[model samples]
Target: MSNNHGFARIYEQGDQVNYGRSNVANEERHHTRNAEGYRPKDQNKAMNQMLEENIQDDVAERYKHDPTYRATMHGNEPSKGAKIDAEIQREEEELLRRKQEKTDSLPGKKQ
Candidate 1:
């Protein structure tokens, strides 16, 4: 076998030697962007931002002061009794609303 600089193979018996240099590339671009440890400093600001868009500003402020309501809002503190009470209250309110809507929809109720 002729030992040519380009044509000559490095390994004598095994598969052809494929050589390319690998460097330690910086992984900064592959990192996930997120708020690692960010939390709102102001309680009111945090609450307002987390609240639903349809939630009234005054009602959200009032809810902030209620301990039971707050506990139920966040899952941190469990309130089984409060949850049951809320469910019952919601059903009652929903029934009342449906009744009012049905009454209003009637032709003789109000024009």
Candidate 2:
């Protein structure tokens, strides 16, 4: 029968039909349904802490292996904190310049 064939087709394609809608269903099944709408405080804390630890370890490893990074960290070769401060100042100035350029590129701005 035609109706029987349609039901069989639906049964065969059920998994594919539900695949695209499974993410929200999976999240609802796995996560707590919080009505308060507030984010879980410690949800991202562990990830952020792990990332920070990894970054520190990488920086330490770089300082050990790379001469330029060692100099920046230890303030050994380029006159201590002055070089670091100058580098930060230069970066800030560069960022400001880029921002100004973006603003200038916008329409209806009188140069």
Best by TM-score: 1
For candidate 1, the clash count comes to 0
- Residue by residue across 1-111, what tens digits does model 2's lDDT show? 134322232233343122223333343353444212323333233233334455778898876544456666676675556566667767888999999999999999997
Model 2 lDDT at residue 108: 100
Per-residue lDDT of candidate 1, residues 2-110 (tens digit): 5444322333564334332121011112223222223423322222233322255555874754435767567566478766766777788899999988998988775
lDDT of 1 at 70: 68
Any residue pairs clashing in model 1, and if so which?
none
Off by over 4 Å in 1: 1-68, 72-75
Residue 90 lDDT (model 1): 76
lDDT of each: 0.46, 0.51
Each model's number of backbone clashes? 0, 0
- How far is 56's C-alpha from truth in model 1 (Å)? 11
TM-score of every prediction relative to native: 0.36, 0.31
68, model 2: CA deviation in Å?
Answer: 2.6
